[model samples]
Target: MSDFTDASTEPDANVSGATPAPEATPEAGTALDIVVLAGGISHERDVSLRSGRKVVDALAEAGHNVTLRDPDATLLPYLAEHRPDVLFPALHGSSGEDGSLLDLLAGLDVPHVGSAGAAARRAWSKPVASSLVRDAGIAVPASIVLSHESFRELGAPSVLRVVQRALVGDLVVKPASGGSAQGVTIVASPDDLPRAMVDAFTYADVAVVEQRIFGTEVAVTVVDSGDGPQALPPVEIVPTDGVYSFQARYNAGETTFFAPARLDAEVSSAVAEAAVLAHRTLGLSDLSRVDFIIDSEGRPWFLEANVVPGLTETSLVPLAIEASDRSVPEVYDALVRNAARRG
Candidate 1:
């Protein structure tokens, strides 16, 4: 049902614009008090909590005194009273991914380990990030955005017909500004388009309906540690149900991941460069992850970028760090140190 090809097995080639990162040293950030923000009021609260817990453990293991904190009413007052050395936000979705909360953190002069407020806003919206990357000469899927009000007032049936006519192929419909793959549907037939649109609307006010290009789904995690951002080995995702839904992303063993995706050297290099370009083009800071679906022609199509990449047990970013020859604590420690230095 996909346009998959055998081009992945070709020999390795030098990835252009990708420089190897320096060896990670864990001593840069030691014995500092850190707060891991998690458990936000988003559809991904549980996932965020898991990520926060993992980060707390990693930072604690790296010799930092870390505590997990939820975004509660008392959060601001608490931060004002006792400023931690660094704040590592492991929250995902809405308030966490969008610029609002980070802006508040900035107002408090809180040094957090992720993108700044404005850049997160740019990267949080799927349509905005896709347009920026496409304009940057990266190949992105052709898609259209629809608001719930327009879909309802203009009539769902009519809109569906127009959409089907415009994107005459398999399609992937998802919320325009949410993550963890919540409210995402793959519509292989016109009959399912309306249902997918409704499902997407439940997650966000706007939905992005993009043409589906079948090949391989990979997540490229980009991390920065004082030096410029660098792309880690891409993680290829293979879901049993053929879609990387929320269940596949959080549930262990529900999806199989291959680090350093089984792509020929040339294709691998291209994917890495695309990820890095997306990061820089989006103006993302600290860390991010770029998702893509490589078409049969061996071209990687930009899917969406995550300003706050997941770091759960089953998350791709942690796996990417491992593949990069660094322990999770080492990378996280360095990120905390970098943020503290900037602060």
Candidate 2:
């Protein structure tokens, strides 16, 4: 666990543990030369770039010296020459989520935001993360993992029959890895299964077909400024087309969101508890967003955890941070300041 402490929960309060330099913001002890890493060779490249830009703006506004950098050959060499105090990796999809880049940062001894490489790999794989969370007493939908090679070599018809028999319900088909809902398909009809599998394979070599429970879809963002991970107020997602696709996620006005989730206090608290438990169970660090489907019975079923959640204007994490009575710049500033001290 990180040695950093929770700096400040108030919207405009100063950081408690650190004594700031006169010119620095009240959040950090000193002005940090922070790098916001964004824009990678991933399906969500555009989204990643947007997220990075937003983060850079927030950090700068909070009085930290921040720069946005893309992943390139020169990135490593540049970091070696002028190592920034902290790296807020604002990357999404395989290029960022798969843990390769994070592992590289650790090898360079650069303090960064989010989970370690190994833990990231576990959370990035939908099947692996679901299994681990389920083992930890969280309820997850029934699911199966199939690879492109297996679907082809072993025959798609037979495989589909087996999967359909085992998981009988409205299904959500998606890539095992990747983010921004790039290649997800909701298969409510039996005839849609084959096509959905094909769509999922376009985004990844493996596809995860899971039972889709009908419920209120929500995102609970878990952030650890210094204290252990705490769940922010849940954001209830209601897509006009009834599916939270890539377009609905990034496009403004495509979806309606409710902060605090309009849930009963008991349900809300339970959801928060489940989110925090999932964060710790997955060994996530810094921050994470746990997606869930709250069934009619008010049970929150685990969907997946995003270690590097989007920070775009329409993103749920920003909405949650705002609803929690905290400003994004203040919270992010404290996180960056704490990460720098951990190094």
Candidate 3:
């Protein structure tokens, strides 16, 4: 049992005696202590900063004692000293999404508004995440992992032979660990494989080459708030360039988003359920967004799980929530409510 009862569930900190270690007293009425993480050594640092700003503003408006902090060297010391009740980690990619920071949070014994350390680490690597999810009974497209160092030392001829033996036609090659589509390429022919490999290697040591699935691309947001986990409505992605690349994700006018996606009720429900299942199976906590590909047979195939997914202006979760008639502030509040309970 935790020393502090989750704030959302406990009637009050005074009643439960489960408030965080800091000297946090309610001002006039009820006040929650919130620490939102914005910056990290990630390629998506700017986006994470924006996400932290939005989350901090919303939580502050919701009458919480909010603290916004970047994961600078001072972060651990600040956390140790302040002991805020809840931490909202809004970081993206690399150090933010990897398990290391989450592990540090575990050491602090603080409740964060995101996935657990193990799950985040697993999902940070594309190939590993895909394999783990698929083995857990989720359908996934065939994929392969290639090492750039090995390719360089052993040469491309042998690597090419191995990849051809392992995968089939039309592949998506991307950095194994990074996100926001950094250094990702779609190779339709053998001639493009070398260039794609080099491009992917620029971002990460390992690259993932996945067989393309013919279907709709969608993302489902899942939140676990002690009531157990549940999935939000699905968001269908249609990119103008026929790929949901970095530009499509960030550039304002490059893609069209459809919420509750144009799928049958049964299929939609199945996808949502599958997402929740994946979240639980990975042992992630609080929240995560599961990406998928709906095949020609109308079956959903798991692509990857984002433990600390993007939460920017053009992010998908807010849109999906709005499609369900939930406002952004309301959604943010729900996370706070859940974080309180998580304590």
Error of 1 at 265 (Å): 1.0
- What does the lDDT read for residue 179 in candidate 2? 88
lDDT of 1 by residue, 1-343 (tens): 1112222122122111111223334644247778888887898887787777678768867777776778888789989998988989887988688999999999999899999889999988899998999999999988989999999999988988899889988999999998988999999888888889989999999999999899999999999988999999998999988889898887766788888788888998999999999999999988999999988888999998998888877789988888888999889988998999999
Task: Kindly report which residue stretches of model 3 are placed more than 4 angstroms away from their true locations once superposed.
Answer: 1-29
User: Which digits, one per residue and each the tens of the lDDT, describe model 3 over residues 218-327?
Assistant: 99998766678879889999888899998888667678888878889988998998898888778787778999999878799998888888776677877777777877
Residue pairs clashing in model 2 are: 5-226, 6-226
Error of 1 at 225 (Å): 0.7
- Candidate closer to the true structure by TM-score (higher is better), 1 or 2: 2
Question: Following a full C-alpha superposition, what root-mean-square deviation does model 1 have from the true structure?
Answer: 9.0
How far does residue 16 in candidate 3 sit from its true spot (Å)?
31
True-structure RMSD for candidate 3: 8.5
Pick out the ten consecutive residues of candidate 2 with the lowest summed lDDT. Answer: 10-19
Better structure of 1 and 3 per lDDT: 1
Worst 10-residue lDDT window for candidate 1 reads 10-19
TM-score of 1: 0.91
